[model samples]
Target: MPYIEVIHPDEAEGRLRRIYDRVTGPGGQVDNVLQIHSLRPHTLEGHMALYKSVLHHPRNDLPKWFLEAIGVLVSLLNDCSYCARHHAAGMKRQMSGDTEKYEGCLEQLHRDHPGEPFSDAEQAALEYARKLTIAPGFVVVADLTPMREAGYGDGEIFEVNQVAAYFAYANRTVTGLGVHTEGEALGLFPPDGEEWRHG
Candidate 1:
């Protein structure tokens, strides 16, 4: 159970209802994390504001899909199952329900060899995310040159890094707050197809 009693969608009001509409509009459904947030609407509002500012920042060029992928990866590293599943659902939606590609990204990185088949850019990015999520103090100038060599400008790399950093905070908050999961929502994803194979 959550630290505070989570409110149902029908019961939310004031700022909570407004935030809920923003999060779950156009036939969208609220996730358990949002339900948990219904207990403290102001913090939820602040979170949504931060999320929007980072995700839709005008100067950023990183595709939302790539940023979301990094978020899933970071969530996995953080061992936050709710975030992992939620971000994976977002990635699935962004990938047009390409579950294979989403899972393939994970399989590729799990290779036994030190340097696997991923591109220099992808490898550098994964390494950077790992370092930032696992050990922030160790991230340094030496770690960033690879991203630069991979053609990411300073601003772009900063955006990527900040997204990774932010998700680490998100993962902890969601987990610590006892956010629930609806694994069935993952059924919306399938390996392939116009109609979902599962769910």
Candidate 2:
């Protein structure tokens, strides 16, 4: 249960109701993360917009699966099981039914020190996410060398940075609020299946 009383979708009105409607899917399902922000509906709108722009934007050079992996890694490092489980499921889906590969990734994530088994590109991104989440102060321009060596240009690197940074913000919000999975493992959704363009 949430620490504070959240306005359930059924009880939403006016702008809140519209926001709820936009987030709701075919089965009348809304992500728990969104529901957690129910008390501040405008913030929820901002959150969703940022999420879509970061992870679902068509121009993103990083594969969707890799972005999901970064999300899971950041969530795991923060011990935010609520976000981890949801993004792990999203990552698994991106594996194209390769359950074994997904399991291997999970094992890697669960290790005391992860990333050895992954490619340099994955390791670079994961390392960035780890540092950004756990010790943001230590991050430096040199820390991005591996990602650049892995062929990520400034834009791709920016996307990775934003995705990791967003999840850190999100994980803290969920953690500080005492939010739990609570049988809710829904992934973030894009509004109307639309992608936001970057300048």
Candidate 3:
């Protein structure tokens, strides 16, 4: 349950009801994170749009699994287990349940350093995310050099930046609001495809 009052999916009406329809999982389930914005449905719409554009859209060139991994790392850094668990499940699904890859990502999430299973480019991106999340004000233009040296194009660099920043925003949203996964379908993802997938 969230700290603030929220309109349950079933009890919603008008604009909120319509938005609920688009994001509900099987059995009309909605993540508490989404419901946190129930008092202001427009913000939920904005959040959904930003989430899709940065982390789940088809045009994003960065690997989807990597994006989800970034989400996990950021959530962990912010101590937002609500997102960490959900996205770890999403990452596993994205990798098609490859145990080795999933475990590797789990291990990698514990530290922000470059290591086995992650390419040089990926390490640099992870480092960037760490700095951006831990201390965004300290991030300088030179910080992007490592990613550029590792062969990431400006577009791909932008993708990494957005994922880190977006997850940080999501983390604050979850932690600050006292949100939880009490009844959420942990692995259901990409918002519009909400369903009760076991995680």
Model 2 scores a TM of 0.90
- Candidates in order have lDDT scores of 0.67, 0.79, 0.85
Where model 1 places Cα greater than 4 Å from the true spot, the runs are 25-28, 56-59, 97-100, 109-118, 183-199
Error of 3 at 115 (Å): 1.8
Candidate 1 colliding pairs: none
Q: What number of clashing residue pairs does each candidate have, in the order they appear?
A: 0, 0, 0
For residues 1-199, write the lDDT of model 2, one tens digit per residue. 7888888888889998888777776467676777889888879889888888787777788888788888998999998988898888878877779888788877887764566556788888788878888899999999999989997788988988999988988898898888776655365445324632111
TM-score of 1: 0.80
Model 3 alpha-carbon drift over 4 Å, by segment: 191-199
> Could you tell me the lDDT of residue 80 within candidate 2?
94
Prediction 3 TM-score vs. true = 0.93
Q: Which one is best on TM-score?
A: 3
Give the Cα error of residue 141 in candidate 3, in Å.
1.6
Instruction: Flag clash pairs in model 2.
Output: none
Estimate the TM-score of every prediction. Answer: 0.80, 0.90, 0.93
Q: Write the per-residue lDDT of candidate 3 for residues 97-177, one digit (tens) a residue.
A: 688978987898887574668889988898999899999999999999999999999999999999999998899999998
